[model samples]
Target: MAITSANQLELLQTAEAVAREKMIDPALVVEAMEESLARAAKSRYGSEMDIRVSIDRKTGRATFTRVRTVVEDEELENYQAEMTVEQAKQYMANPAVGDQFVEEVPPVDMGRIAAQSAKQVILQKVREAERDRQYEEFKDRAGTIINGVVKREEYGNVIVDVGRGEGILRRNEKIGRESYRPNDRIRCYIKDVRREARGPQIFLSRTAPEFMAELFKMEVPEIYDGIIEIKAVARDPGSRAKIAVISYDNSIDPVGACVGMRGSRVQAVVNELQGEKIDIIPWNEDVPTFLVNALQPAEVSKVVLDEDAERIEVVVPDEQLSLAIGRRGQNVRLASQLTGLDIDIMTEEEESKRRQAEFEERTKLFQAALDVDEFFAQLLVSEGFTNLEEVAYVEIEELTVIDGVDDDTATELQARARDVLEEQAQRALAHARELGADDSLIEFEGLTPQMLEALAEDGVKTLEDFATCADWELAGGWTTDNGQRVKDDGILEKFDVSLEEAQSMVMTARVLLGWVDPEELEQGNEDEIDEDAVEASEDEA
Candidate 1:
C-alpha cells in the first residue's frame, strides 16, 4: 500500500506541464530523471557497481541498469574484469589483447523507493528554475521605483513583496516615523537585487538620495525629458534634504520646475517620504556662492576657504548661526555634502573677532616699524620700501582710503609715506636689474617727464625700480595731459613690463651698470639715447 507508484505517471505529467507552462526546457526533466534513477540504483545496489540510467524523451519512461564483465576466474572483480578470450570475442568484434565488451542492461522495476527519489528530483528542478526566473524578472528593475505591499515588519525591517520577489527594507532605509502595516501598499526605490541561497534578494530603500531623484523624475516633466538635471542630492530622510539642480535649456529654471505651482510637485514627494522638508538650490561654479546657496534659509555673511585644509569657515549672523547649523547640525551636514566642503559654522561676532585679531597683529607690526595705523604701510615695507625718497614718487593717498585709516593721519603720514614709496621704487629697480634689465627706462605712453623726475627724486631711477611700485602707488598725484588724476591704476599695465620681465630688466641693469657693452646697449637710436637726460635739458632748450 505504498503511495510511491500510485501517482508516478501523474507526477511525471505534472512536471511536463509545469515545464511547458514556465518555458523551462523538458530536457532538464530527463536530466533530473537520470540523476534520480542513478541515485536510487546506487542506494539499492552496492556503490562499487557501475549504474546506467536513460530516459526516452518522447515517452518520459526511464530505465535503470548496471553493466558487469564476464570473467573466467570467479575471484576477478570490477565491472570490466579480465575475461577469457572466447567470452570477450563473443561480445566484442575483432577482440584483441586490450579490447573490452559492452552489454545492454535490462531495465529495473524502479520500485517505491526509486519513484519517491524521482519525485524529489522533479520538485528541486522546479524550485531552482523558478528562482532563476524570479532573478531575471527583478534584476532589470534596480534604481526604478516600484509599488509593493508591505508583508510584515520584523525587528525594524519591513519585508515588502515586490511582485516576483521579496525586497527587504532595513531599519535605516525607512523614512523616520513612517509606519507600515501588513499588506500596506507603498512605493520604494529598488536599491539592488542579489542572488542568495534561499532566493533572489531584493534590497528596497526609501531613504536613498536616489529616492528623491527618482521622485523628481516622476513629477517634473523637465527632469523626465532630460532638460533639467538633478546634479546632486543630500538628504536626512524624513527631516530635510538639499538638492543641487541645473538645466540644459536656457529657458528652464530647474529648481522652480521641480517645485511646481505652490510647491505641489515637491510637496507630493515630501508626502511620499512622510513629510521630509526639501531645499532646492541652484548649482554654481563659484564655490563661495554655491556654499551660500547650499546653506539655505540661513543667511551666510561670508565663506572663508582654507584650500590647503579643504575646509570652509561659514560666518553667519548670531541669530542665523543656529539656523545654518540646523537641528543637530543637519543643515551644515547636507550643505557640506552638496558643496564638498568640510564646513564649520561660526557666528558673525566670532569671525569679526578673528578678523580683528589679524588686523591688530598686522597693525602692531606696522606701528612697530613706523608710527602709522595704515596696514598698507606694512605692505609697502614688505614690498621693500623703507625710506622717505621711495615714498615721495609712489602715491600713498590711496592707502588712507583703505579700512582703518583716517584722513588727518594720512596727511601727517604723507611725507614719510612718500619717502618710503620712493625707497621701495629704488629697491624694486635694483631687484628688477638683478633680474636682467640693462636698458634705460622704457617710457610708457602716458607717463610724463615730470612723473619720471618725481620717481627719480624718490630714488626710483630705473625701469627695474619703476616696475616694483605697487599699482595703488600711481593712482594719485600723477596728472594726465587733461589735468585729471588716475587712481590705483595698475602701473604694470601702464608700461609693457610683466613683473617677471621687469625683474629680469633689473637683474640685467645690476649686472651691467655703466659697463653695459655696446652689444648690451645696442637697442636704440641716438634720440632715444638722449631720452634719459632729456628732462634736464628740456627747460634750457
Candidate 2:
C-alpha cells in the first residue's frame, strides 16, 4: 500500500502529538518528517539530484523541491547537484555562482517500504530528542535532593520514577538498614547524571555525607540564612555521625542554634537517618581548641602539638583514657578526621614517662658532643641544647652564660664541636667513593653521602646516569620492601632529599655535563636543540 495525497496532513498531526508526549520541541519532529519525505521521494526524482521538503506549521501541508546551486565550471564537484552559471542562466537571467535555484518536484506517493523507513526515522529522532532533553534537565541537579517513587528492583538495584525522568539507586547507595518496595516514595540525592548509549542515567545516593549535610541545610533555618553554618560532617551510615558548626555572629551559640528549640531541627535530621546519633560540636579557630570540642565527653589535662608533623598528643586523666578513645577508637578517629591531624591519646602517667626519657637522651647528646662532665652536660641540656648542631651553632657568649662556664672553656667547646662535624663529613665522603659513586656525582654540591649510596645500589654509578635521572627518581620514594627491608614510604622518607632539591641537582648535572641545553630545556622543544646545547657534551666529557 502507498500513502496517498489525502494522508499528508495526518503525518504532520501525528508528529506533533508524539513530540508533546515525549516532552520535546515539536520542531524536531517536523524536521525529522521532512527528511523522511525527502528520502522517500529520491526514487521518483533522480537519485543524484538534490531534494528537499518542507511542511507548513499552520496548514499541515508538505511541499517538495529540487534544489541545485549555480557554480563556476572549475567549481563543479557534482554535475547533478551543481549547474554552471551559463546553464543556470538558460532558466533565469543574470544568475551568479553560489546562488541556489529551486525546481519544483512532484509530491511523494510513499509506498509500504517508504512509509516503514519514515516510521523508523521518526522513532529514532524522538528517542534521541528525549535523551537530550533529560540530560539538560538533570545535569544541573546533581548534589541536590530529588523525590521519586521506587519502580521496581532488578538484581538489588532499585529503579526510580522521578517526575520528569527515571533514575537508578544502586544497592551500595542505599542505607544498609533501609529497605524499599515498589511504589515506595523516597527522597534521594542526585550524585551524578551520565549520558550513555542506551539513555541518560541519573545516579542517586542516600549514604553520602553530603546528603546528610543537605538534610541539615533544609531542616535548619540558621544554616540556610547564614546565621550559623555547618563546617564538616562524617557519618557511619545509620550507626553514628558527627558535625562541626561555627557561628558568624558573636552573640549566637553555634551548637545551641544547630540543636534547635528543644532539639527540633537536629531531631528531624536524625529521624531521617533512622535514629543515628549525631554529635554537633562548636567549631574553634585554633585547632587544639577545636579538637577539644570534637572529643566531647572526655576531659583533657595536657596537649602536646607537633605542628611540623601535623600530629597532636593529648594527655587525659587515667580514668578518662578509654572514654577519650571511645569504643573501637571511633571518638578519637572522628576527632582526627575533623581536625586534619593524626592524634595520639595517652594517660598522664604515660606522658610523664615519655618526658623523662627525652631528658636523658638530650643530656647524653651534650655530654658526648661538647666533651663535658655529667653536671655540665645536665646544665647544657637544661638550657635547651638538644643536639650537637645547637652546641656548634650557638654564640660563644651564650655558652659562657651557662653557670660555671668561663670564656676559655666556651671557645674550646665550640672549636671541638666544629672539628667533629668536619671529620664526619670527610669520612662520609670517603665511604661514598668506596661504594663506587662516580667522581662527577661525588663532586655535586647538593647530594649527600647517603643519597649517593642509595643511588649506587640502584646502578646509577655514573654522572651520565645521574644526568639521565628523572626528577621523580631523584625525589626518592621508589624502593620496595621485602625480607630484611623495612616498609618505607619513599627513599626520602628515610633520608632528607626534598623534591625541589632533587630537581635542581638533576637539571644542573644535565646542563653542566652538556647532555642538555639550558635554553633548549627552557624552550621545552624536546625535539629541536640548537648546535650549542649538543656541541658542549664532548667538551664536558
Candidate 3:
C-alpha cells in the first residue's frame, strides 16, 4: 500500500466507514489511521528516527514528517532523533536545548508484513475508542432499568445485548432459577458500570431491592412524579418482598396509589419479578409504627424498641407468631431489612414471662444491696427503682409516696442505699488497685469506681492509656462484619459512659498530659459549633 493521490482519499473513506460501523467519532478513526501510518513509516525509515503522520480532515491528505529534538550535550542519546544545541546550529541561526526540528518525509510503501502490523495497530486503537465510547454512554445509566435481549448463558451467568453494549447478569444477581434462551427479552437494573481490560462491564441485576423500587417508579405515575416516594424496599426475590412508601400529598394514599386501581400497578411489578409476592405498606416516621406495618397480616401486641442498638422486640399473640415469622423466618427477615432493625419476635406469653423474670431479678438486687426483706424489695421494684443509685439519689418525696412509707422511712431507706453503694464503690476501688490501677486514673473526675475497675481489667490502667483510647472503644459501638452488625463491648459501657462523655474525658486527659494544645482544642470546638449553626440555619431556610 502506498500513500499516493489515488489512495490518499481512500484512507479517509475507510476511516469514515469504520467510524460509522463502530458508532464512534470520525476524528478518532482518522487519528488511529495517522498513528498506524506513522508506525509503518518508522519501519521504513530508521527505527531510531522520530516519524510522525498527520491526515487532513477536510481533503483526506496524508503528511509525513521526520522530527529531531535539540538537547543538552550530555542528554543527546538518539543521534537520529535528538541533536545537541551546538549541532542544531547548522539547521537554524540559534537553537535552544528544547527545540524540535521537523522535515517532510516521503510516505512508506508498506509491504505485506508492515501493512498487517499497521492494520493491527488501527484495530487496537479503534477497539479502545469503542470501549471508551461505550463506557461514557452507559456510566450515567446505572441505577436504572434497561430492556435487553438475552444473548447467551455462560455457566449460570446470562449475557444480554443491551444496545451498543453488552451487560452481564451474574448468577447471584438473577432471581432464583431464572433461565433464559438466546434472544429472550429481559428487563434488568443497571447495578454498575465499570471499565476493565477486556471492555466496559455493565453489571445487570434482577434481584436488587432497587430493581423493585424502580419497577414501581415505572408503573406508578405518582411515584414518577414524586408525589409518592418509596422509602424502603426488601426482597426475597422470586419469593416475597416488602415495600414501604409515603405520600407527600395528604389526599393521596401512598399504599393505595402503589397498589393501583384493582391492584393494577403492583401487579405489573409482580409479573416482572417472576411472581414475587409484594406487601405494600405505608411508611411512617415512627419506626415502631413502620415496623408494625412491615409485618402485615400479623397482629402486634406490643413493640419495644432499643433505639441505640437499632434493635426491636415485638410481642405478638401466640396464634400470630407463625404468621409474623413467616415460613422459615422470611417475613421477619424482610421486615427487619425494610425497617433496618434487628427484630426479636416473641409471643405475648413469652414477653410477660420475661418481664416477670426481670422484676424478680431487680427485687433480688434490691434485697441484697439495701438489706431489705423480700416484700420491701418488691415494693421498691414496683416503685421503679431498678438500681441502688436511683434509690440512693432519688427525691425523698418519691419514696414517701409508696404505701406505708413516711418521710422518716424514706430517709432511712436512702441512708441504707447510699451506705451500701459506698461499700460497693470501696470494694470496686480496692479491686481496681489490686489490678495495678494508678491514682491518675482513679481520680479522673467523671469515671465511677466500677469504670475504673473495668478499665484496669481491660489493660487500660493509667491516664495515658485512657487518652490513647478511641471514644467508640470506651462507649461500645456496632460494627458491620460480613454484612451483619456485631456488638463491640466497651470497658466503660456498663457505667453508662456515652460516646460524647468518652470523647470529652479522653480530650481532657490529652490536654492534661500536654499531648494536645488546649487552645487548639477550644478553637476546633468553636469551629465545629459555627459549622453546625450554619447547617441549622440552612436547614431552616
Candidate 4:
C-alpha cells in the first residue's frame, strides 16, 4: 500500500495494516504519520519554523498548521515563531500574551523519498510501542510458568513464541535430559523479564529450584490447595532433588501426601522433570530434625548443633557415613542447601575418637595452664572449661561451684588464667608495634590487643582502615561471594568480636574519624550540622 496517496482511505487502510502487523495501536500509527508529515512540512517551510500536523481519524486527511504564541512586544524571543499582541490583533482583536494562533496550510503532496521516510518513522514508532506492550505483558508474569512453542534454536538456546511475544530459554536454563526441535511445546519458569533496546527479553528457566517447586505445585493437588506447603527445594537439575514440605493439618502427613498413592503424584512430577529422582521429606521448625529428615535412607544417631555459627555436626552409624554423605557428597550438599545450614557428617567411631582427643587436650591445657593436678583438671574439663579464657572471664561464683574447688582456690586459679592471657597480650602488642601499628589505634577503646595484631598482620595499620572496615570484616563470617556458604572467618574472628560488637566498634571508629556526627545519627536527622570545615567529610564516607 502506498504511504502517500490522494485517497485518504488508502492512508487509513495502510495505517491499520501496519499497526496490526506491528502489534501496536492504529492511533499510534496515525500519530507517527502526523509526526512524519510534520517533518516533511518543516523541511520545505524552514526547519526553524514551528509547524505541526494532524490527521482526521475517520477521513484520514492530513492537515498542516503554523503555530505562534502571541506575546507583548517586550516578551517576543523569536520573530518567526512569536508575534506581538499588536501584530496578532490583525487575525483576532485584543490578542493577549500566551494566546496561541494557528493558521491552517494546505497539505503538501509527498514524493517517493518522503513516503519512504514516513514508512521508516511509522515502523520505528510501532516497534517502540510493541516493546512497551511486551514489557508490560511479561513483567508481571515473572515466576509464573509459561507455555510456549519452540520457534527456533540458536547456539542451543530455544526461543519460544508465547503468543503475545517471544520467550528465551537460554541453553543453560534447559534441562540436561531435554531437547527440542521446531514447533515442540514446552513449559518453563518465567525466571525474569526485562526490556532492552532490542525489545523485551523474557527469560525462561528449567533448572531453577523454583521451577521444580512450581512443577510439584501443578502436579500435587494438596500443594496447589495450600494444605501442604513446600518449605524449601534444592535441585541438581535432572540428577536428583530434595524438597521439604509441611502440612498445616495434623491429620495429613506431609511426606506421604507429597509422595501420593504408591508414589503416583511424585512420579508425575518426576516424569515432567525427565525422570529425575525426588526426595520429599517432612519439614520441621527444628533445624536438626529437618536436617535428619533431609538426609533420607541414612539413619542419623545424633545431631550436635552450633546455632550461632549456623553449622551442624551429624553422627551416623559407621557403615552409614558413606550413605549419609552420598556419592560425591551430593546428599549432604543438598541437605545443606534445603535446610540452609552447613552440615558436617561423621561416623560414630570418628566422633568418639574426636571427642576423646579433645578431652585429653583440654585436660592437659587446664593441668599446666592453671597449675592444677590431673584430678582438678579433669573436673574443670568436665565443667566445660575448654580454655584458660573461659576460666579467666567466667564469674568467680561459677568457678567456685565446681566440685572440690573452694572459693580461695577458684580465685587463685582465675588469677593464674588472667596472668597467662595478659602475658600473651603483651607479647602480641610488642609484635604489633614493631609492625608499625600506631599508638592511637592501640589506645582505641573497643579494640583489644589480639584484634590489633590481626589488623597489623594484614597490613591494616592505619586508623583509616579500621574506620572503613565493615562489621562482617571485623567480626568475620561476612559473605564475600554470592555462593551458598562461607567456608572461613574474617580477620577479626581471631579477636573474638561478635557481629553486634563489631558493628558498635565500626560506629565508634566512624565517630572518632568525625565522618558521621554521633548526635545526628542518634537523632535521625532531627538536628544537622553545617560543618563544612571538617576535612575528608563524605570524601571517604
By TM-score, the best candidate is 3
Per-candidate TM-scores read: 0.61, 0.84, 0.97, 0.86
Q: Is candidate 1 or candidate 4 better by lDDT?
A: 4
Candidates sorted by lDDT, best first: 3, 4, 2, 1
lDDT assessment of candidate 3:
0.94
Question: Lowest-scoring 10 consecutive residues by lDDT in candidate 1?
Answer: 484-493
Can you tell me which runs of candidate 3 are displaced by over 4 Å?
none
The weakest ten consecutive residues by lDDT in model 2 span 483-492
lDDT-best of 2 and 3 = 3
Q: Highest lDDT: which candidate?
A: 3
The deviation in Å at residue 136 for candidate 1 is: 2.7
Provide the RMSD of all predictions against the true structure, rounded to 1 decimal: 19.0, 7.7, 1.5, 6.1
Full candidate order by TM-score, most accurate first = 3, 4, 2, 1
Q: lDDT tens string, model 1, 1-541? A: 1214454465467657878876676667657667767766676676776677776555545566665555555545564435655666767766655454545454555677677877798678777877888889899999999999999999989999887678999998988878899999989999999998998999999999999999999999999999998888999988899899989998888888999999999999989988889999998888898899999999998889966345788899999978898889899999988886678888989988987686566556556445664766566455555444444444566645555657766555665655555566676656545544434653443344444444555566665575555544443223245533333333343443344454444445544444345454455435566886797689778
lDDT of 2: 0.82
Against the true structure, candidate 4 has what lDDT?
A: 0.86
Of 1 and 3, the candidate ranking higher by TM-score: 3
| lDDT of candidate 2 over 392-494, digit per residue (tens) | 8798888999888898888888888888777766776677777788888877777676667677767787788888877656664333355222222433335
lDDT of each: 0.72, 0.82, 0.94, 0.86
How well is each residue in 28-101 modelled by candidate 4, as lDDT tens digits? 88888889888877776878778899888998877789999998798788887899988998988778898999
RMSD of 2: 7.7
Model 4 clash pairs? Answer: none
